[model samples]
Target: MDVEALNALMRSEFSQVANDFIVQSVAPMEAVVRMPVAEEHLRPGGTISGPTMFALADVSMYLVVLAMIGPVTLAVTTNCSIDFMRKPTAGVDLIASARIHKLGRSLAVGDVLIHSEGMDAPVARASLTYAIPPRST
Candidate 1:
């Protein structure tokens, strides 16, 4: 799927928080998702919350899988390991760049680097494994 198709899928399938993210781009084995940081996503320290970034990483990888495999909503995260590296820049959108390390018949593995807009280094990094359900023949 391309950017528009992915964004539309997010809206139709994941409407609860669809407004929070935008699909920026998609290429072979990769995708970029942007989450516009909002007041609700902030913690007491004026920094983006860990859960918020985690969601971004998860969704980013989900989109990458869909971009390559088509709209497989059953493709779900089976494992995730994320490291919070640094404080995210306050009041800026977060960008998640996800690359698929491997894509198999039933699984996809990828990593996401989330950077605060205009920042040099990533604020968080995540490695994820997704289980893609067997397609109906």
Candidate 2:
């Protein structure tokens, strides 16, 4: 699936948080997703929260996998290791660029770098592994 298709799927299957994420672009084994930061996504310190960034990284990888494998909703994240490099800009969008390094029949492993809207370096980086449900023959 491409950007539109991925966004549509998110709206249909995960309506509650659909508005938070937008599929920006998608290619063979990679995708970029943007999250428009809001008050709810910020912690008391006025910086984007870790959990929120984690969610962004997770969904970005999910979209990347779906873009390559089609709308296989059962594909699920099995492991994730994320590093918070710095505090994000007060109020700006967060962009997650994910690339799938390994794609196998049942597992996909990738890394995501999340940047603060206009920042040169990433605010966080995550390495994730997802378990793709076995396809029906």
RMSD, every candidate, angstroms? 0.5, 0.6
Candidate 1, residues 1-137: lDDT per residue as tens digits?
99999999999998999999899999999999999999999998889999999999999999999999999999999999999999998799999999999999999999999999999999999999999999999
Reference-based TM-score of each model:
0.98, 0.98
Candidate 1 vs. true structure, TM-score = 0.98
Instruction: Estimate every model's Cα lDDT from 0 to 1.
Output: 0.96, 0.96
**lDDT by residue (tens digit), candidate 2, 79-109:** 9999999999968999999999999999999
TM match of model 2 to true structure:
0.98
Please identify model 2 stretches exceeding 4 Å from their true place: none
Off by over 4 Å in 1: none
Q: What's the distance in Å from true for residue 91, model 1?
A: 1.1
